[model samples]
Target chain A: MNVILSLIVSSVAVFGLVVIAFVGVWGAHLEWLFGVVIPYLAVITFFVGMIYRVVQWGKCAMPFRIPSTCGQQKTLPWLKRTYVDKLDNPVGTVAVVGRMILEVLCFRSLFRNTRLEFGNGQEIKYKSAKWLWFGSIVFHYTFLIVLLRHLRFFTEPMPFFVPIIEKVDGFFQLYVPTLYQSGLLLGAAATFLLLRRVIDGKMRYISLPADYFPLFLILGLATTGVLMRYVLKADVVSIKELTMGLVSFRPVVPEGISVLFYIHIFLVSVFFAYFPFSKLTHMAGVFLSPTRNVSNNSRIVRHINPWNYPVKVHTYAAYEDEFREKMIDAGLPVEKGAPEPAKPE
Target chain B: MYDGGKIIAGIIIGLALLTFPIWYTSGRAAPKPEVKLPVKEKECVQPGPYMKKKHMQVLDLWRDSVVRVQQRSYVAFNGKEYDMSLQNTCMSADCHAKKSEFCDRCHNYTGVVPYCWDCHIPPKEKPEEKH
Candidate 1:
C-alpha cells in the first residue's frame, strides 16, 4: 500500500540521518561537515530555492480571474447580505484583502472542511470536520514559538523579547528545567497529523510520500530536541557557543556537546533543504494561490486574459470573390458578375 | 514576474528576519564569559562534566528531598557524602563564594534567570581586585 511505502521510506530516511550525524560527529570526529558545511549549505539552499520557487510561480500565466465563492454575492439592493458573505464572496479589492487575511492567518477555508458519510440506502451525509484544522493550527503556532525560543542560542545579546517569550512559554513551571509546552505540543500535534493520514482510509489513499516525509521529519526533530533538553541533558553553554559561532561566520566546535545536539541540527538542516522543493512551499505559495487571492467580481469587472492573442480570420467577402468565376459558371448567384472578368488580364 | 513589486518586497522582508542574527552581530566577536573558579577547593560534590550539564536538575532534586522527605545528606556517585545545603555546601567561603563572580558569569552569558536567588540570600560581592 502507498501508506506503508511512504511510512517506511520516510522513517528510514530520518533514522539514517540520525545515524549519519551521530557517527560522523561522535565517532568519526567530522564536526566541521555536520556543524558548519551542511548547515550553511542547507540555509543557502533554502533561501535561494524559496526565491526561485516564488519567481517561478509569479511567471505563471493566470488567464482566468476566478475566485472560489462560497457565499451570497453582493448584488440586488433589496437582498440581505451578512458580513461573513462579503469575506467568502469577496467583490472589491478591500474585501479580497480581508478574505486573504482570514485565509492566511486563520485558515478559514480549512476550518470549513467537511467529511462525507455514506448510508446503507444510497444516502449520503456531510459533516463538519475541524480536527485537521485544530491540529494544523496548534502545530504551526507551537513550531513558530519553538523557533523563536531558539534565537537565544543564535544571537549574542539575546534579543529583548526572547526571554519574555521563553518565560511565558514555561509559565506552568512543570519540571526541573522549566518544561516548555511548545516542544511537547509540537510533537503531539505532529503525531496527530501523521496518525490521521495513516488511519483515515480516504486520507491515506490521497497522501503521498511528500506528506508523510515532513511529518516524520518534524517528529524526529522534536523527539531529539526533547530528549536533549530533558532525558539526557546537553551542555547548553557549549551548544550556544557553537551556534553563535555559526551565525557570526566564525565557526567553532565546542568540546563536550552531546551527539544528540548534532542529530537535532542535522534534522533541522535537512528540513531547511527539503522545504522549498516539497509541499511545504505552501508557506509562500499560499499568498500566490489565484483562487484565494483574486476578487470574485467577474460580472462587475471584465477579466482580460493575459494569455489571449489576436486571432486572424478570412472574411466571407474575400472568399466569395476568389470563387466567383466558379460560382457563375455553375449558374449560381454572383456578387458583381465575376469581378468584371478580371479587367481583361 | 506577474506581481513583481509585492513579491520582491515580501522576499526582502523574509530574508531580513531570517538573517537577523547574522547581520545584527555583523561578524563581531562575542567573547565567552570567564568565571573565577575557587582555587582553594577544587573537588565538587560531583565531577565537572556532570555539574556542567545537570547542575540545575541536581539542585532541584536536592530542594525536593530537603523540603518534602526531610533528607539532608546527598551521596554523590563517587561515594562522597556532603551536606545538602546550598549555602553551606555549594556557596561556602571555600567553594563558589561571591555569587556575582561564579554564578552570574555563565547565567548572564546564557540569559538564564534562575530563581534560586529569589528565596535564598545572595552571597556578598567580592571587593575590587588590586591593579
Candidate 2:
C-alpha cells in the first residue's frame, strides 16, 4: 500500500509538471516564463538550497567517534589491519577518504550490499545485489555524461572536451541525428532502478515517495528529450540562442522552439527545485554522513564529546544504604556485612 | 529537540538568495535579441527568422560540405542556391559589410564565440560618416 501510494503520488506530480509545461507554454504561450524565468528560478533554488542543506548538516556534531567498521581494525603491531574498513588516525583518515572517494565514485557500499532470502524455505541465504549497484553507477555516470554533452549547446565555439566527448559519444555514427550511448544507458538504468523498486517486495516496502519521484521525473525528462531529438525535432540554433542568452544573463525566448523542448526544460526545472529538499541530496549528504566520513580508533585514542554536560549521580554508598535489606534478602552482596538486613523502611 | 529556528532561518535566507535574480529584475521585462540586416538583399539563401534560428546548423552543413566532403554549392531551405565558400558567401556576398555591427553584435550579446572568426579574417570596420 505504501509503495503504491508512493508511486502514485510521484507519478501524479510528474504528470502535473508535464501538463504545466504543455498547457502553460504551448497553450498560453508564456514562452519567456517557461523558457527563461523558471529555469533561472530553478537554478537559484538548486544552488542556494543545496548550500544551506550542506552547511546545516555540517553544523551537526557527532558525539561518538563511530565509523561503520566492516573488517578487522588496526591493533597491536602483529595484527593485520583491514585498513580502509577500520580507519584509525591520519593515515586511516586518508584511507577513509579514499574509501569515501570510492563510495562516491562507484557506490562501493551499494556494490557490497547483500540481499537475504529463503534458500530452502527453512534457512535464510545472503546473495550479492550487484545489479542494483551497477544500475546506480550507470545511471549516475551516464547522467553526468549527458549533462556534459549539453554543455555543447550552452557554450559557444564549444569547449575543447565537449567536441571530443561528442565525437566519442557518437563514434558509431550509425544514423542521422547520431545516437549517444549515455542517453540510452541512462534510460536503461533508470528503468532498471524503477523496475527493481516495483518488483522487489522488500525494496518496495522500504521505498518512499522521495525515491520514486526522482526516478519518474528523470524518466519523463529523458523521454521528452529523446522525443525532441528523434521524433519531433527542435531548432538547434534557437536552442543555442536561448541557452546562450541564459548563460550571458540575458535570457531571450527565440521564436519557433517546440513545445516538446519546453516540456523538457520545465521538467528539468522541477527536478532542480525538488532536488535540494528531497533525498536526492544524497549526492552531497553522502559526503557528510558520519558513518562513512569519520575514522574509528576509540580504543587507541580517547574519544570525547565536546558538548557533553555534567549529570548528577547517586553514589554507591547511597545506593547500598537504600537497598541493603533488599540486597541481603536477595543474596546479593551488601557493602556492610549481612545481619543489618533488619532495617524497616 | 532539533535547532528548528536555525534551520528555518537558513531556509529563509536560502530562499531569499534563490529569488535574488527576480528581485533585481522586478518590474522590468526581458528584452528580445535584435539582429540588424543589410537594407537591400541581393538574395538570401533562407528567410530572416530561419537564418536567426538555424545559422549555426547551416554553417555546420556548409562546413561538412566544403571541408569534409569537398562540395562547392548547396541549396538552402527557401530553394535558393548559395556558394559553399565561407569567405565568399558570408563575408563578401552583400551579407554584411562590417561583421562587427551585424554578426558580432548578436553573437557577443548572446555570448556565443563563433569558431568561423578563429580561422577566417574578420571584415574591416565601416568608417563613421562625419557631417
Candidate 3:
C-alpha cells in the first residue's frame, strides 16, 4: 500500500539522518559542517526557494473573479444579506481581508470541515470533523511558539519577549529543566495527524509519500529536540554560544555539546531545505490562493483578461464605403448617394 | 507577476522578521559566557559534563531528597559522601562562594531564570566593576 511505503520511506529517511549525524559528528569530527555550514545553507535554500515558489505562483494570472463562496451574492439593495454572508462571500476588499485573516489565523474553513458518509437507506450525511482542525491549529501554534522560544539561543542580551514566552510555556514546572508544553504538544499533534492519515481509509488512499514524509520528518525533528532538552540533555550554554555565533556570522562549535544537538539541528536544517519544495510551502501559498484572497464581486466590476489582444473592428461606415455601389444597384439607400455620383469627377 | 506589489511586500516583511537576529545583532559582541571554575574542588557533586547539562535536575533531586524524604547526605560518583544543603555544599567557601561569578554567568547567558535564588538565600556579592 502507498501508506505502508510512505511510512517506511519517511521513517528510514529520518533514521538515515540520525545515523549520518552520529557518524559525522561522533566519528568524523565534522562539527563545523553540521553546525555551521549546513544551517546557513538550509536557511539560504529556504528563503531563495520560497521566494522562487511565491514568484512562480504570482505569475499565474486570474482573469476571472472566481472566489469559492458558500453565501449569498450582493444583488438588489432591498435584498437582505447577513454579515456572515458578506464574510463567507466577501463582496469587497475589506471583507476579503477579514476572511483571509480568520482563515490564516484560525483556519476558519478547516474548522467547518465535514466528513461525508452513506447511510443505510442510501442517504448521504455530512458530519463535523473538528479534530483535524483542532490538531492542526494546536500543531501550528505550538510549533510557532517552540520556534520563537528558540530565539533565546540566536540573540544576545536576549529579546525581551523571549523570557515572557518562556515563562508562559513553562508555567506548569513539570520537570527539573522545565518541560515546555509546546514541544510536547507539537510532537503529539504531529503523531495524531500522521495516524489520521494512516488510519482513515479515504485519507490513506489519497495520501502520497510527500504527505507522510513531512509528518514523519516533523516527528523525528520534535523527538530529537525533546530528547536534547530532557533525555540526552545538550549543554544550554554551549548551544547559545553556537547559535549566537551562527546568527552573527561568526560560528564556533563549542566543547561538550552533544551529538544529540547536532542531530536536532541537522533535522532542522533538512526541514528548512525541504520546506519550500514540499507541501509545507502552503504557509506562503495560502496568501496567494486566489479562492481565499480574491473578493467575489465580478458583477460589480469588470475584470479584463490581462492577455487579451487589441481587436480591430470593421465599422459600419467602412462597410458602407466598400459596398456603396452594390447597395445603390440593389436599390438600397446609400449614405452619400453613391459618393456624389462619382461621375462628376 | 500579478499583484507584484502585495506579494513583494509580504515577502519583504517575512524576510525581515525571519532575519531579525542577523540585523539586530550586527556590529554587536556576543561573547560566550565564561564562568570562573572553582579551583579548590576538583570534582562537583557529579561529573563536569553531567553538571553542565542537568545541574537543575540534580539540584532538584537533592532538594526533594533533603526536604521530603529527609535524606540529607549525597554520595558523589567518586564515593565521597557530602551534606545535601545548597548553602553548605554548593555555595561553601571552597566550592562556589560567589553565585554571581559562577552560577549567574551561564544562567544569565542562557536566559534561564531558575527559581533556585527565590527560596535559597544567595550570598552577598559585590557588583563586578564595569570595564
Candidate 4:
C-alpha cells in the first residue's frame, strides 16, 4: 500500500513538472520565463536553500562524542588494535581520516553492511549486502561525470580540461554521438536502487515517497537527456548560444533550440530546487553528521558539552560560611572556626 | 530549543544573497549595442538578424578555421569570399571603423569578457591616411 502510494505521488510530481514545463514553454511561449527567469530563480533557491540548511545543520549542538564505531575500541595495550574496525583511534587521526575517506568515496561502511538471512534456532547467518554499495558508488561517480560533461555549455573558450573530460567520458564511442559510460551506468544504478527498494520487503516497509521521488525524477531527467542526445538531434549551436547568453549574463531566447531542451532544463531546475530540502542533502549533511565526523577519543580527551551550563554551584566555602557554627557543632571539620558546645546538648 | 528569529534572519540573508543578481538586473533589458553601417560594404557574411543573434558563434568558427584549420578565406551565405582574419574582416575600412562604439557597446552590456583583445590589438585609433 505504501509503495503504491509512493509510486502514485512520485508519478504525479514528475508528470506535473513535465506538463507545466510543456505549457510554459510551448503553450504560453514564455521562452524568457522558462529559459532565463526560472533558471535564475532555481539557481538562487538552490544556493540559498543549500546554505541555509547547511548553516542550520552546523549550528546544531551535538552534546555527545558519538562516533559510530563497529570494531573493538582502544583498550589494553596488549590487545590487538583493529585500525579500521572502530578501534584504538585508528593509529592516530590519519586512520580515522582514511576511514572517513573510504566511507565517503567508496561507501566502505555500506560495503560492509550485513543483513540477517533465514536462520535456524541454532544458527544465525549474516549475509553481505554488496548490491546496495555497488549501486550507490556507481550512481554517484556517474552523476559527477555527467555534471562535468555539462560544463562545455556553460563556459567560454571551452576550458581546455572540459573537452578532455568529455573525451574521456565519451571514450566508449559506442554510437554515432559516442555514448557516455556514465549515462548508461547512471540508468543501471538508478534502476537497481529503485527496484531494490520496491522488491525487497524490508526496504519497501521503510521506504517513503520522498525516497522514490528523486529516483523517478532523475530517471525522467536522464531519459530526456539521452533522448535529446542520441534520438532527437536538437540544435546544438543555438543551444550553446543560449547557454552562453545565460552564463555571460546576457540571456537571449535563441531561435531553433528545441522544446526538449526546455523540458530538460526545467527538470534540472526542479532537481536543483528540490535538492536542499530533500534527503539529497546527505551530500553535505554526511560531512556534518556527528556520528560520522566526530573523533572517538573520549578516553584521551574530555568531550565537554558546549550547551551544558551550571544552574547553581554550591561550593564548600559558601556552605562553610553559611553553616560554620552548625558544621562545627556537628563535628564536621571547619576551616577557621573553633567548635563550641551546644546548649541543647 | 529553536531560535526562530535567528533562523528566519539567516534564511532571509541567504535568500537576499542568492537573488541579488536577479533583483539587480530587474527592470533592465540586455544592453543592445548600436549597429552602424560601413561605408565600403553594407552586407555581412550573414543577414542582420543572424549576425545579431550569432556573430559570436560565427567569429568563433572563423577563429578556429583560420588559426587551426589553416583556412584563410571565408565563403559567406551569399557565396562571397572574404578574408578569414578578424583583423581584416571585423576592423577593415569597409567594416565599422571603430571597435569602441560598435563592439564594446554590446560586449560591455552583456559583460562577456572576450579573450580576442588579449592577443589582437584594436583597430588603430584613426585609420591610416590612404597613401
Best by TM-score: 3
Q: Please report, as a residue range, the 10-residue window in candidate 4 chain A with the lowest summed lDDT.
A: A83-92
Query: How does each model score on TM-score?
Result: 0.91, 0.69, 0.94, 0.70
TM-score, A chain, model 4 = 0.91
Candidate 1 chain A least-lDDT 10 residues: A336-345
Looking at candidate 3 chain A, the ten consecutive residues that score lowest on lDDT are A336-345
The per-model lDDT (C-alpha) reads: 0.88, 0.76, 0.88, 0.75
DockQ of 2: 0.13
Can you list each candidate's DockQ?
0.71, 0.13, 0.75, 0.05
- Steric clash pairs (candidate 2): none
lDDT tens digits, residue span B1-131, model 3: 99999989999998999899889888464788788888988999888888888888889999999999999989998999999998888998888888888888888888888878778897766676211
Interface RMSD of 4: 8.7
lDDT per residue for candidate 1 within A174-234, as digits (tens), equals 8878899999999999999999999999889998888888998999999999999898999
Instruction: Output the lDDT of residue B54, model 3.
Output: 81
For every candidate, what is the interface RMSD in angstroms? 1.1, 7.9, 1.3, 8.7
Q: Is candidate 2 or 3 superior in TM-score?
A: 3
Q: Can you tell me the DockQ of model 4?
A: 0.05
Instruction: Put down candidate 3 lDDT per residue, A139-205, tens digits, no spaces.
Output: 9999999999988888888889999999999999888788899998999999999999989998899
Q: Name the regions of candidate 2 deviating beyond 4 angstroms.
A: A82-91, A120-124, A310-345, B1-131
Give the Å error, residue A71, model 2: 1.0
Q: Considering only N, C-alpha and C atoms within 3 Å, which residue pairs clash in candidate 1?
A: none
Off by over 4 Å in 4: A85-92, A119-121, A327-345, B1-131
Model 4 in CAPRI terms: which quality? incorrect
TM-score, cand. 2: 0.69
